[model samples]
Target chain A: MALFSSLTPVFIAIICVLIGVILKKTNGEKEKRETKSKPLSRPWVDEDLKDGTDHHLEEEDVDEEWQGLDENVAHVPFFAERYSEGEMIKRSQMFYELLNKRRSVRFLSDEPVPREVIDNVIRTAGTSPSGAHTEPWTFVVVQDPYLKHKIREIVEEEEEINYKKRMGDRWVNDLKRLRTNWIKEYLDTAPYLILIFKQVYGWLPNGKKKTHYYNEISVSIACGILLAALQNAGLYTVTSTPLNCGPQLRVLLQRPANEKLLLLLPVGYPKKEATVPALTRKPLEDIMVVM
Target chain B: MALFSSLTPVFIAIICVLIGVILKKTNGEKEKRETKSKPLSRPWVDEDLKDGTDHHLEEEDVDEEWQGLDENVAHVPFFAERYSEGEMIKRSQMFYELLNKRRSVRFLSDEPVPREVIDNVIRTAGTSPSGAHTEPWTFVVVQDPYLKHKIREIVEEEEEINYKKRMGDRWVNDLKRLRTNWIKEYLDTAPYLILIFKQVYGWLPNGKKKTHYYNEISVSIACGILLAALQNAGLYTVTSTPLNCGPQLRVLLQRPANEKLLLLLPVGYPKKEATVPALTRKPLEDIMVVM
Candidate 1:
């Protein structure tokens, strides 16, 4: 009789757990259906609201002025061409392969490239999105032999100081595998040296200055695109930042004081025997978190 | 006779100018032919080199140790499939057009997004190139409702203070056209809030710090890729940087002190009636220089 009573309680417990599992699965399906039913909803819209209340009007007075401001601005109709899912995957994979081949080459050839090619690459880079559309960047192309030689000398001088003094022992040690030194023959050897300058603020016609927001972040994004464009053109380049050469470079390039040197790119073909250190990228699991 | 002599000198000068023009045209053609004949030259090989000296050996002493260093490190063979030039252009153009369609939306839908979609987009973002391939970035995905609500409240508090006190009058005026306010409902409404934290330095197994290079520039590139990836996935997102929310967010998220907040992205579908500001990008000529 005791064994029957205990067994009866265990059977009841199992039945309750099964019922709970079934209910949970049903709720999950219901939630998914609800999500699909309304992929996009605007509760703030007056026509969609069940209650006869316009919530937008309840905002502050400053926000009311914003609507008037929007009216003053002009907008053009825009429609993007949609691609099939398969097409998107193909394009993404192709781009990934293209970018994968890009490497920073130190040994650059002196082979002359057409000026039009450089112009097109820079234009492609300018297509990068910027903060508030400020486009606070300037791409200066240097091909003059004298100017290239001068830049090379100045960069070497600064880099020598950096290698010996500015950079800590550990920092220098980390760069050992890169096999780089104070000597930068590529600066003069490369046919083109594109100097990217970040504009801190804009100069108005009235001689007043307008502030640029997220200038550093915006310029960095543009530089990344610039590197990609150069590589896409089958050109090899290195992102070289010669410490303390900014002041001298500004004077040599005759740029305004408002412009700061952001990055220096020596673009050309890679030498036949050019080599890079073997480095492995972190696996995707180490860099991402999924919830 | 004197007038005839003067006319003869002028005619000779005009003839010389014509000859110079003809010579320049011929030189341009010859240069183009030369470039085409040897598009990619392997001069480092012995056949092409006039001198037997290999310039690679002349580098600094530390560089000699690099080949030894390569032996210690592991390498995986990488070969990306090549594409024709015409196909490359087509793909680049398609990508450019797709990215052009991406707009920063203020009104976001609260629609539920598939977890797998977010995972794929983040993985795409991780493929960005970093300085020395350090890949010093961490992506934090925030989806919990309570946590989202808390982030929204804190971001709003900081933005309100910024609009009133921190931002100068000129900066505020510039933002008037966008019709943005202190309120940030999208932070809570969006299904995912991706917080990108930059690792300034890494902690080794031995409890030593390993310095990261170009951390700011590296993170910015990753953020750009993240934006492109999200847009590619048919999702709308805005890069939101609400200053002064870093400290509180770190505490809430429980991230280490070394990780600095670089960018905050709220990803979701745009509201059905969502509208964006009409802003034009700078013309190509204004941002690029050719010499």
Candidate 2:
């Protein structure tokens, strides 16, 4: 009777955690659950992994299938039909409300945002699709005033050189309109800065193997999703690649050898009054050519 | 009067031809009038080719006052209100209508789509944002049965090795859920295969140089936009990057050295009967975080 009582408490605790986590993730799709027909025809569990009912792999790297086909033959492959060609798009209500309203702020309010916001935004970015599912990324949130200054100083040093020496007359001439400089004020002004990094191929978690595939696409997908999530959260962001601070900043941050910094985004509210360049977009007709 | 009439015909004919050529190059954003903030701000005009402007360079390379910024920098450093962040993020009627309905399709039909659709789609893809607006990309529409056969032959070769030999038990175990293999039938089954290439940089018409930034990011953004556009047009596509075909396909296509084949997407209709593996996305809590 005592053992049963103890077991009951543990099971209930696990259920509570699961519920909390589920609540955290569930969003616009809740209403569409019933409408979802299984989109695939292939068996969810491979014959090798199925142990009568459960679906996860029972063990790692157990490659028993020696199924081979002639490389030259263009055989018809299987495609499951859980999702139809026309109905896979799910416009998220939460994201739509948020991303549709997001504004890029050049001038920022110096007010510090709740740390919770920064952490959550980074967490959302971490869920992006990566090459070979490598999940090759790192997020460094800078809240320290001193570190912000240091980053700014290093970035400015490079910008000055670019403007003064490295950048050619043609390139500098093009940049003349927006009046951008190497000294990024947003780096210092915004309460938080999230630096995104893409890890090239790296060792597996077991530290025994190499992996391959397109990581750039995977990282960009994550970035796209991140942009949508941040906008939904009632914040402003600018995804800017800091060209000048590459080598120096990486050393300053002490990143791993395999990682390359992709973008340094400044996140916060716009200044009480801010102005963006009035840029025009190409017309839809110009972009779209329907047959 | 006769002299005037003769000049008018000649002038009008040249202007018409010029516009026809320009129109072909103008991706999507041509509908918006070029914002005329200043004559100096236009991207097309050669800044150095001054026609009695306030400052003409006599000693360009030696001039210390000239900011080290490249001459190209003057080409509208930022595309002014070309798009407001809000406008850029808003769901366009076409984009919304299409993106809201997008589904990834592994199923493909052998029925050939008209070359017109392929032409229009590739033209649209050209408008995608590129690194430094270099537009460093090439699309090889492969409908040639002979070449498609060659591509499938090579891709399967590596994939066969990956699935059976090189892939570890852990890697194999993780891949079981996706239910994919070295077997690729879509290459032949789809009516048209769109091969995307990333050109690192390009030469100007004058043989001067240009540089591209974040080429992969730029290319992927274009790909996302292209995918969204293609899906919106009621066409189906699946993005596949078979890096194994990088050398052979490039040689086959005669792409320049800098260009890398990144994605080989087969575009057409999903087969009446198609099957995909049973896969469920991670719950919202697992994928999204709230601050």
Candidate 3:
């Protein structure tokens, strides 16, 4: 009789466990269906996953990607001198005025500029922020007359076709007021042409391809800074994007196939009689919206 | 006999002119054939098209594109106080040093920031250069908790799939050192989220679509400037790009189809116990090549 009583209790315990498992699985499936239907719900909250406390900071053994690279980092004490609000406003205004005075110049003088100036300007450009610090850019300084002559020839050939046939009527009409033609004398006359090439991918020492993220955006930021640097040095430049520059220039410059030409900037002094079309930028109010 | 002699001279002159025209046409055809074969040769040059002389500046009646727009331009007297070369160098160095100290912060505090500060920072971003001065960008500031919660949930949902399935092994391997996972609590915790939307095309008042040029590059430059402005104001922000953020965020923010989401920045003060991955930027020589 005692043995039978014990057997009965064991059977009841097994049934209770089975019932709990079935209930838990049914709840899980229901929650999944709800999540699929309404994605913007607070269904996926795990209190343990939150890094809200100071405990995460105490974990010094965390494996970060940089830790695997074993790259050396230099620490330097930084102390930025605080400026009065008035001084800050004054400096901001000054920078705005300086940038506003910048204009695209077509009439260039063949006056020679020091190589050191170009070097400094490029260094300033290098300071631009990039995605993941993958600075995928190379600035090639072309000053040789022969190379410039060759580039000009190719650019003009393409531009001639662009103006005559490739460009639609509306495009041509829009450019009429700018008075730009296929013949680019400035390309030949400028003292320097900074050819910015963007590296789409990189090769490791073992020949594995390294993918670059935001290469176009990163290079464009550098180009903007380059313009500012050149202007600050009392030099003028025009942002030229010659169609079909990638294939021809790559061959001429002996650059690898991985790099693509981004910008061709003809940099030099403006001719004494240099004139730009009387153009005005949209007012600040039109461009900016306050919400 | 005198009349016959005069007519004969006139006939001789006409014959000489015809022969000259024929010879010029033959030479032009030959040059075109040569250009087709050897495009690097300088086959195009028009002395009249060159703007080297100062005479073009004297013409006031030249029709400019802006002349047709009839937009009122405010001509503010701009007289930037010139700094000595030494002072200029000092200022540039200081600015560079300040920027170098900026690091991407992940842990954010929900400390309330003044609206005026955000306004100034956005104004600074508006000053960035754009393609043809089109200024094709819109910055939408979101401070509503409900909207942030929705964005966070969507981002985390996609990120979870990305970490588990969508992203390849190599990409996940790369992200390991960063110690990041699908959980992004900063989106909800940060006081303000600046959603930068890039205008792919604009709708005119009459509902006609206006094409934008270099829209991607222009918006990227503005984003860089925005980051700098935020840093300059002693605020912290992370350049967060939640994958598949376009369609969902567009619906949540009520943005138009023509505008695409470029960046989603979470801005606020860093948490007291915030810690970042120990990473180092590539040195100048690694990033820049002067040729």
Which residue pairs collide, candidate 3?
A64-B177, A65-B177, A65-B178
| B124-172 per-residue lDDT for model 1 (tens digits) | 5666666555687888899999999998998899789777866545456
The candidate that achieves the highest DockQ relative to the unseen native structure: 1
Residue B11 of model 1 has an lDDT of: 54
Off by over 4 Å in 3: A1-98, A111-117, A228-235, A269-271, A283-291, B1-94, B112-117, B189-191
What is the CA-based DockQ of model 2? 0.03
DockQ of 3: 0.04
Report the candidate with higher DockQ, 1 versus 2. 1
- TM-scores for all candidates: the values are 0.69, 0.53, 0.66
The regions of model 1 sitting more than 4 angstroms off are A1-71, A75-94, A111-117, A231-233, B1-95, B111-117, B231-234
Window of ten residues with lowest summed lDDT in model 1 chain A: A43-52
- Whole-model Cα lDDT of every candidate shown, in order: 0.64, 0.52, 0.62
lDDT of 1 at B104: 75
Q: Per-residue lDDT tens digits of candidate 2, residues A1-291?
A: 646644554555455555544543352244233122211111111221111111112111223332221123333344432333223222222222233334445676797666655555555555443443446566667777888889889878877876776565555654554455675788889988777665543454445423323444656655654554455445677766665466676677777655556666788777766664333333334333221
Query: What lDDT would candidate 3 get against the real structure?
Result: 0.62
Instruction: Report iRMS (Å) of candidate 2.
Output: 29.6
User: Over the stretch B65-156, how does candidate 2's per-residue lDDT look in tens digits?
Assistant: 33332343222222112233344334322233334344456678897665655555555555443433456566777788887878788878
